[model samples]
Target chain A: MASSIRDELLKVLIEHQPHFLSGEEISRRVGCSRAAIWKHIEELRHEGYEIEAKPRNGYRLVYRPDRVAPEELAPHLQTKRFGRHIRYEYSTPSTQTLAHQWAREGAPEGAVVIAEEQVQGKGRMGRTWHSPPQTGVWMSLILRPPISLAEASQLTLLASVGVQQGIKRVTGLPIQIKWPNDLLIHGKKVCGILTELRGEQDQIHYMIIGIGINVNTTSEHWPEELKKIATSLAIESGGHLHRATLIAAILKELEEVYQEYLNSGFRVIKSKWEQAAGMLGKTITARTPQGLITGVAERLNESGALLIRTDQGVIPVYSADIDWKEI
Target chain B: MASSIRDELLKVLIEHQPHFLSGEEISRRVGCSRAAIWKHIEELRHEGYEIEAKPRNGYRLVYRPDRVAPEELAPHLQTKRFGRHIRYEYSTPSTQTLAHQWAREGAPEGAVVIAEEQVQGKGRMGRTWHSPPQTGVWMSLILRPPISLAEASQLTLLASVGVQQGIKRVTGLPIQIKWPNDLLIHGKKVCGILTELRGEQDQIHYMIIGIGINVNTTSEHWPEELKKIATSLAIESGGHLHRATLIAAILKELEEVYQEYLNSGFRVIKSKWEQAAGMLGKTITARTPQGLITGVAERLNESGALLIRTDQGVIPVYSADIDWKEI
Candidate 1:
């Protein structure tokens, strides 16, 4: 297959990076003709990879692109199939839009849409997200889960746990998962998870879990309004991170958590999340459209709804903007 | 606007149906040019209505198609904007798909999509619906309700109440909303509802509520296997029913109920539904993926989950396939 030939050529280039190989040498190494090597090189160039070709020398990897490519990142990935079918976009309005379209068009499970820049990325409540070019991980994954919408909220908690674990694994920075869907680092938000679904009353057709992490972005990249409440991996680690590796790790962890969630209930994920849950047993004020409700964060119920024990009663809050009290 | 022009032309045609009118006469009646009349007629024809025009005699109404056209149905509708903006299609894969797309594309709050037939119409549990041409109401409404996903099941009940009220208003047939999402007449299904949503943790962007009703279908038109379980309005009413009028009534009732629901809680709708509920205090068996639960259907909780008093306790059933013991 043409894909296999291209894969072989990519393997050779990756192995002999920073070195120039003649066309004849590459062809011989990949067990293909020099013309085939040239074709694959052209294709790689079209894919935003920088492969320099000289007259006598075959090809040299002058610059390696930081993209979520299976060939480049699969060796570092631990799980299967989650990040295997990735679609990289240089600029898109929204990764959630692309993922939903792909899911409707029968894209395989574990399909991902990653964009280097988003012109109109969104957060919860129709808020505009700050996704600068090549400074963060803005990705969405298509998940085909056999669950009801009532149980769908668990996916948000699961994704938060995975993102927390991934960030911990990459930069050794401790992170906490806020009650519903925020990844907090040093008491500031470092990532947000938006889970959306399309399904009937009893069956879910597909769900798109979108994640936006401020990786490699400096505090200066954030707007003045968000500087106090937002943090990034680069700012925490005092160095820039490899976006491709971090994304691969996040996808792998997400796949693992997703499988665990499907096999077992949210018990495992919930246990891990509870360990990193910083707001449990603390008094907090949640501002809902109905009104503000101040209560102690009791625990998460079986369906992933936040249980708040107030003076009135134990109210299962489906969604609210939380404001924690000073510890 | 061109749409207003088309509305005017539609008004003229409906007012003077079954009679041939010269282009000049139509232009004079609507104060528009003959060329504008011809263009509006073309647009209406493209919207699935049948209009025959002769060179000199004029345009004759060959078929007054039963479709949910904004202009044709708006005058008869009593709603406050819900279903006021209509998009009619002769054939579509599914109205819900189109409605979802429109909702994502920032369509208005009360936008609706109606189709004469759906090639890939789907019901709950991945079942293919029987939506033959001009035989059913394949309609989907875009609703932006201020509710969480956990509370969305109530919307299905609200829609069922509205549908039952509409059918009662038009045909005087007493119908019941089978728990969760079906409209039944005389122990057989006449309509099915599918509600889907797209949103994040703390906010709901939009929801598409799809309704499929067997309106003018005959026994022979249904699949042989479905004949025992499905019935149409014509079958029950002992006469032919106009699809456009029925759709308009449904939308009008839906708008009223939706407005009340947004203004208040589900108290009004739930009380109305409880009066027509056929399964209350009845022994029922629900087959869920977890296990089969046998209990007496006591009531519905505030969140719209079915409360079944089983031997263990009062089990709150969120999603299940139910079977009536007497049926």
Candidate 2:
């Protein structure tokens, strides 16, 4: 009930942002006393909502926190279904695991799970993601597409395209994709996408695409190993960006790309992925479970395999960790 | 407590199946009073176990019920892992659902869920399987194999081979496999296999393989629609067969075949599948999601796709319902 009152208060404030709603009117609108309203407003301020209060005119929403809390995100999200139903966590082991839980519980398609901090953030192949509190956009989205098992990999590529376009729109940085689904700026990793799925022999049941973006995350806190390979939007742009705005931008872009995929297929977005990839004709080494193979990364084929030219042959690599040499 | 006592009493009786333990010895072995032992014995008889009580002998195992219950299956199962833990439901919505539940709770690989009746038995592409009570073997098993997504379908083929070999060994009835994973006898389906999986972009997390075999199910109990297309072991053999024995036979064959698959790969089992399939050179029609395609059945490819020689050309089918013309 207290949460509902807060939500109501937030709704009223956001609806009339930059304009004052008198305290009595706000109380009546939220069905709370003026004293209660003041308390919640102070609580909101403590949660990083900047509100301005004058003598006669009661209160106006000045700024929103860089939080991905549903209220902070609802205003910036323009997508129909992507961020409309968000399960936000202040702290969690992994948003990917939460997304899977929600998906199993019949969460709607395109529902989102966002975390301010991931104590045990996940990366591809069981690597720690290192997501700090309110410093990165750590999220997972649920998707259910009627595609074959073979096409599941294509969805990962599609998500990479979304992240590339999203980071471009928000930070004006040209993000390059590292073959399967990692986003980089100036050859330093900024975002990683891990696509997990529930499927049958011939069909995919559901997919959870976990996207972790280092937005406004400072480099001083990075582990020594990550400092060499990873970079953040704040570090690259030399400014702290609004995390809520960044997530909204991503969800908007992702929903559009995902709808495009469902309407036609992955072919329309294939070229977009390739152009952002920039891995073609680059000297690369891929670490596979079988062993390591150094080759010239040729192309990402229609089937989502990274085709590489090696002394052995032009091999289509399915699953691997890629290391590309800088130009 | 009562269930454990029943298990203990069954163990004592089975150890002396042809013989008999005196009431005092039986009560002492079970650590229960003679009255309590007699009550459990009566309950077992009510559940379809046939026990003889002579003047001096406490109990003689006259006959064992055709049940896939844990105790009934314990001695028959010859596998090292498969069916090591049996979850028996006298009636359930679907064993597939229960298996998923247990799996989510960290049930070990090779744990089995069996149901006497499936109120909502699942079939491929959202069809109803129409499983009836205490008649057929409707079961699902959990598997965790380090296999690629493309190779998941091959597991179904391996399972089909297990079912074929099992049926052949148990009833001496030569069973034929439809291209992918259906078992047929005299042109009627005797079993259906559905393989579901949970995976990420790089690796498969787990796969649930649901196999429903029509053993000892009479025609009178079958829904009208299934009468023409489906047949049971009892209907085909003109006599009821032991459901537990058949389940054990399938588990044994499945464990051996599954182990071979894990050790070597599906290539070793490919020829075995082909030998049992008998689908090549037959005029066939495949009803796919796109549309129906008529052709001569060519062969099951290495990737587990059913290659059909259509008028357009030889095409590979991943998911379809088959309609084959009789030779």
Candidate 3:
């Protein structure tokens, strides 16, 4: 359904939250078929909305919009602090831009900036992410990890494990992680992570981790070219999912993983990321700024660098685009 | 005299700039002594103000505010691009803050942000720089150097050399450099360079070089404690100096040095910074976040890291605070 129609449907449902509304009345109000209204209610159920239904009386709201506020998720946030201070906007240019300003203004660590729609959602390498409204989850988290400039890259590896585990736990989907940190399902990308930081020679002042996940976005949200590579959770699972619940689950995992990293070092994250990426002994090409090197993915060294064994020797890749080579 | 009095005196001189005003009349208009008026005029002359003095007349203005505008200095900026798009403010919180916003908004490389006074100027390690009005060069330069994250520290070393040479050429002051770039004169700090960058894991998006110089400030500008460590050009040179001339000279040298870095690597900057800082073979203590290690300063390695020869072995220091040992 169109976002405006869906919003109007939601408004009509909310207006009659105190009493039940008949199916014909709701269908007329929403300008849709009764079967379409039933489908919309199912989608809303998938989105964490509890709509109680009866055979004759009609459907009544189990939770009102004011009671279960989706915009303010702090009370429902289960973690210690990750999403405790979250700001939700209906539309924005980019959440990363606002996160930078907020981080500089001394926002606490674990603060999140989320938006329903992004006109110019940013991607890696100065690219743009395709972000639609009321479907995917787009957010930027403020983090102040006690790490040096050289060790900042490890956080990217750690975040992928947290997010992958969270997705798997929430929807029971078989989410996999690629090299560095790209979440995938069935050989298609489902999420992107953009990590940016402002730092001196040795210390990182703060790091903003921008995450865009295709939670309930459908095929119509992506362009033709992106459809070949990008997939959403709803498309993969054939059912819609709740964005706030998924966000809360990811923050909980991320908080634990981050604390584990600070307490026990990257040892746990290293093992988890290595298992999740599953590129050991595979032939791949790393396209780095220095140049391209086709080699076998040997193993990750102590500092979380991908040490690739090439024809000449083992070259460690810091940051690059990994391409699979079929022989 | 106060800044208000100086501005009022300049206005009075400009009101009768077509002719000349008598000393008594000028002094009466400014509400100051004739001797004080003569001292202020001499100070103005030293500040690159072309004041024509006659026998019976007081003084005639040669450069009106609009005739020689100080804010839009594109004409005076000699480099191909550096400082070509300059924004001069009478007062601001911090030039670095503004430069970041402009850089993100697609400000071209070599764009400069200069201010007369900074109420909350920034310093390295989260300290505040003392920036006074009309007597210091407080500016931030936007740069898009083709470099990696590991090599970004070389820009700081390169900038110190440019600024040091510019000071020498403009005022003939014997300026020296400390490690990582701190400008000193007579064993006291005279200037500071805070190099901040925004980058990914391997590629740098842009770097902002914030330079603060105590150009012609008097001893009264510093607080009771800052007087022990901070000194200015006027205090050491026993004369006032022009702010814009010194700024242009620095920008010229910096542009050249930055170009050399992009063309010839860090070869020129390495030797120049080594000779300027004069830390080789000196017994010093490096206070690093890992721990404090007292060793002899050996040499700068290929990646621009300082190799310190300790009793145990040779350790490379990327960033640290160096304390000298007299023995």
- Highest DockQ against the true fold, candidate: 1
lDDT of 3 by residue, A241-294 (tens): 777778878889999999999788778999888887756778999988668999
Name every residue pair that clashes in candidate 1.
A21-A58, A22-A58, A23-A58
Q: lDDT (0-100) at residue B172 of candidate 3? A: 89
| Alpha-carbon interface RMSD for all candidates, in angstroms | 1.9, 2.1, 3.2
How far residue A234's Cα lies from its native spot in candidate 1, in Å, is 2.5
Candidate lDDT scores, in order, read 0.83, 0.86, 0.80
> How good is chain A of candidate 2, measured by TM-score?
0.92
True contacts kept of 2: 0.48
The residue-by-residue lDDT of candidate 2 on B216-286, one tens digit each, is 88888887888999998888888888888788999999889999998887787887998898677888999
Could you arrange the candidates by DockQ from highest to lowest?
1, 2, 3
Best by lDDT: 2
Encode model 1's per-residue lDDT on A34-149: one tens digit a residue: 88888878888987889987887668877667665556665465667787677778899999989988998998888888898889997877788899888999999889887777
Q: Root-mean-square deviation of each candidate, in angstroms?
A: 6.2, 5.1, 10.2
Tell me the tens digit of each residue's lDDT in model 1 across B66-126. 6655676765777778776788888999998899889978988888999889999978877
Judge candidate 2 against the unseen true structure and give its global Cα lDDT, from 0 to 1.
0.86
Query: Candidate 2, residues A1-327: lDDT per residue as tens digits?
Result: 124788889889998988999999999999989999999999999988999999899999999877789877765778988888889999999999999989989998889999999999989877889999999999999998777675677898999999889889988977789978888888899999999998776677789999999988887879999999999999999999998888899889999999999788778888888888868889999987667989999887656778989999997777888988783
Better of 1 and 3 by DockQ: 1
For candidate 3, lDDT tens digit of each residue in B124-152? 87789999888888999999876555566
